[model samples]
Target: MLLPRTFEALPELPKGKQIQVDFGELKVKNSEGKTVKLYVIVFVLSHSRYKYTEWQEHPFTTRDVLRCHENAMEYYGGMTEEYVYDQDKLMTVSENGGDIIFTDEFQAYKQDRGFRVYLCRKADPESKGKVENAVKFVKYNFGKNRVFHNIESWNEQCLAWLKRKGNYQVHNTIKKRPIEVFALEKPHLREVSAPLSFESNLGSSITRIYCN
Candidate 1:
């Protein structure tokens, strides 16, 4: 029988040690009064709780995820020693017992960046609570009742919101503003030697995987 899930308080992590990444989706009406879904991805600094988010008109492929990873790193001005992720199909092909088989593209990307990864099952509350909260926060607090103007405008609004509210507000758990905490966390983050670029067939997947 499956045991009941428990949410243990997450301990404070070392500065620049790890970041958690998660993806979610929300629906909004476009300029033409049509409903559309946006794919949202977020990355959070484990120590400071600093956050970076991106929205796309298309579902993310492995290459798209790679590029977004680079973007998130640059947004933070660096990367961390490790990344925590859910068992996303974009990265992981399969898992058995404690072993995980990652997608080919993701395997190479991780090796090229030289960072460690810790993945957990979706039901692992202790592991997913933070990021899952972030996703819900974005969906309800920001995306809810918000009109979809365009990808660029939506992203701009998201960035502004992060600065105005998301990272600036005093966190409920830590009792400190994330931006303030990030001042100390930034120095501990690992530097990115070079930005990653994918092109031609390796670039973003503009069309949905099953899109006509």
Candidate 2:
């Protein structure tokens, strides 16, 4: 026999305290006039609804994941105290009895950067609703009807879109432009004392042992 869990309201998050991350896929035409699937990783500040996105030609490896984190942090000009993620293998290895076993590379990155990691429970997309909507907004707003010559052009366009549309538009829930909200949140963000070197080849393996 099993007991049902009680419902609890989501906690109110402070500025620069939490960020939610998710990945979405988009199909775009290449120079050869064939469609290619591109992975778009999204990071959203939970308190301000500010976001950063990166487009990649392939699914993310551990190295790519770290690089993306660095890029997002750079765009935001700081880091948050906690990162919320789904059960993606790149970040998490398993959920053992309510304890999260994170991937080695990500664990090292978290320890090195000194931020906490929070994983949403299985099948609970609402736990990270901000980033989930960000994924959809990117797919429908920026990605739809867009064509790219190559990955480089796609990335350039993404930054342009972020400037012209994504961050500038008033968010429905927040009722303010992300840029405006981010301005208030910016002062609360943690400054990185030393940045990670993405050039270094961190070992990549889906089978890497999880760390508690």
Candidate 3:
């Protein structure tokens, strides 16, 4: 993939910036009523490359997305200045006149945590390349050939694997590990005591719900 001339140079850490979030998924079996396994959505952070993958038994919804972000922030212990996602209807209720109408719970979560949200422009995948790359990397490495006996145990294993692979792996752009860059960014980032203890309005029990 040829990068635009604008990205020819490496990106610098922006002031008051923490990192970005991306959505990803992995295939899993719905033993309750499955003819076969299906894809389970996962969220990843672009800066630390720290990830929180979960199995969604129901159709992905607004609450599911917020819960995912809440969990991710707790797992990382900080918040990003902005969230970048391709225009998915669940998170984005509507868009008009440069204003994005996000879901009620989503707005509450963002307001409570203090971050901005930006939807990727239509048909412009290049705008969020870093997150796209991270998703692909996660699927290929962690999702491949994985038989999850239990999502809880599997997630623990995944987190361990992510720490080893994401934290330690040398980043191509900066030729440094993600954890290294993240460590440098953390001291400058606004510290949050923890994420709010919000129950899943959708009513599913996420093993690692963000109560941090």
Local accuracy by lDDT, each model = 0.84, 0.83, 0.62
Q: Encode model 3's per-residue lDDT on 42-121: one tens digit a residue.
A: 55445544445655445677666666666776666667677777778777788889788886667766777778777786
Which runs of model 1 end up more than 4 angstroms from their true locations?
A: 1-8, 202-212
* Residue 190 lDDT in candidate 3: 63
Which candidate tops TM-score?
1
TM-score of each: 0.89, 0.88, 0.76
Alpha-carbon RMSD of each model: 6.4, 7.1, 5.1
The parts of candidate 2 lying over 4 Å away from their true place are 1-12, 202-212
Ranking by TM-score: 1, 2, 3
**TM-score of structure candidate 1:** 0.89
Using lDDT as the measure, the top candidate is 1
Per-residue C-alpha lDDT of model 2 across residues 18-124, encoded as one tens digit per residue: 99988999897766788989998999899888889998888888788888888888889999999988888988898899888888878888888889888886578
Error of 1 at 95 (Å): 2.0
Residues 1-212 of candidate 1 have per-residue lDDT tens digits of 99533342589889999888889999888878899999999888878888889999999888878888988988899999989898999999998787999988788789888999999888775885667677777777889888898899999999999999999999777789999999999988898876767544844323222223
